[model samples]
Target: MYRAIRIHGYGGPEVLQLETLPTPVPGRGEILIRQEAIGVNYIDIYFRTGLYKVPALPAILGMEGAGIVLAVGADVTDFEPGDRVAYPTSLGGYGECRTIAADRIVPLPPDIPFDVAAGGMQRGLTARMLLREVYAVRPGETILVHAAAGGVGLLMCQWARHLGVRTIGVVSSEEKGELARRNGASDILIGYDNLAARVRKLTDGAMVPVVYDSVGKDTFVASLDCLAPRGLMVSYGNSSGEVAGISVRMLATRGSLYLTRPGLTTYIAQRGALLGGARDVFDLIAQGVLRVHIGQRFALADAGAAQTALETRATTGSTILLP
Candidate 1:
């Protein structure tokens, strides 16, 4: 038997329960992984609070993990026993062991540690999708990133800097501002008040061509104001709360702004996109251009506490759970 965090209903962190279950066996096109680390993301919290619904009750509550494959099922030829692999989009990752579809797995680089792989796969890919595909950020372009010290924000800043893009990072506090600057933010704005004014001033009143906003509701209006005419507003998350009551006129009044709510699954829906995106993320990390910080780690059984820390915004960078 192996242990996993199971949630029978939706609510707060208190709803997460650790339980033992029989080890799963790999079926056709599947592989059984001995999980080493699991990533904690806001999406997990969304699913936990019923903001995002699951398929059924008593479901495992995680989407990413790194592990060693112990067995491969029939027709699974790319992986074998003892292969080190990581997956960013697999469900049921908060467990000691899991059986996942082979197509979803990516082989981990030999030098990349399990913790880094688990912590970065999802977030790194997210940054890649946003910067590379979403707007195709150009060299010397200026952009605004909300929650700039958070996992995806930090990666986006560093990656954008590497590509010669200037980043104006919006952080919640001076400490987070410092963190953002260290990670490649060209300018930092603390707090949300007068956000557009600050961003405009930083960009010499021209405003930015894109605003990557993860803090929904509270920062939505200000994010729109920070954009240039016909700019893109990538609203990817809702750490503050859901963005609502948006009308077509809002976009027209905001200079023909374009808005998108892209998901990791949609960005990497195809096999080629999945492998290619993951490869780019891993390659950037291997080259040291992208530094992934494993800020906090908790034992698998303490996932509830981990979730609490994440929800309270008490942790920075990436948080992981060890099995």
Candidate 2:
């Protein structure tokens, strides 16, 4: 038997329960992974609180993890026992061990630590999708990133900088602002108040061509206002709350802005895309252009506490759970 955090219903962090279950076995095209590290992310919170629907009751809640392959199932050609692998988009990752579709797993380089891979894989892939695929952020262009000290934000900041894009990062506090700056934010704005004005000022009144906002509700309007005409507003998350009650006129009034809510799953649904994006992110890590910080870690049994900390925005960079 192995331990896992399972939730029967949606609510707060208190709903997460640790329990023991029989170790899962691999089926066709699947591999059994002995999880070394689990990633804690806001999406897990979303599923926990019923913001994102759970597929079933008593759900094991997590989407990413790194581990060693203990076994491989029939017809799996690319992996074998003892492979170091990590997945960015699999459910039921908050466990000591679980079976996952082999295609969803990416082999990790020997030099990349399991903890770092767990913390960065999902967020790094997210940053790659947003910057490379969503709107194709280009050199010499200025962009605004919300929650700049957070996991995806940090990666986006650094990767964008590597590509010669200037980033204007918005964070909740001065400390987070400093962290964002250290991660390659050309300018930092603290708080949501007068966000458009601050962004405009930083960009010399021209505003930015793109605004990658994950804060939602509280900052969606400001994010729209921060964009240059016909700019793209990539609203990828809802840390504050979901954006609602908006009409097309809002976009028209705000410089013909284009809005998108892209998911990493959609971007990497194909096996080639999945492997290619992960390779790009890993390559960046190997080059030292992207630095991943695992700012908080908790024992797997303490996932509830980790979720609470994440919900309250108490952690920075990436949070991981050790099994």
Which tens-of-lDDT digit does each residue in 76-179 have in candidate 2?
99999999999998989999999999999999999889999999999999999999999898899998999999999999999999999999888999999999
Query: Across residues 1-323, which tens digit of lDDT does each residue of candidate 1 receive?
Result: 99999999999888999999999999999999999999999999999999999999989999999999999999999999999999998779999999999999999999899999999999999999999998899999999999889889899999999999999998878998899999999999999999888887888889999999998999999899998999999999999899999987888998998999999899898989999998999999999999998889999999999999988888888999999
Flag regions of model 1 displaced more than 4 Å.
Answer: none
Could you tally the backbone clashes for each prediction?
0, 0
lDDT for residue 37 in candidate 1, whole number 0-100: 94
Error of 1 at 77 (Å): 0.7
Task: Give lDDT: candidate 2, residue 122.
Answer: 98
lDDT of 1 at 113: 93
lDDT (C-alpha, whole model) for all candidates: 0.93, 0.93
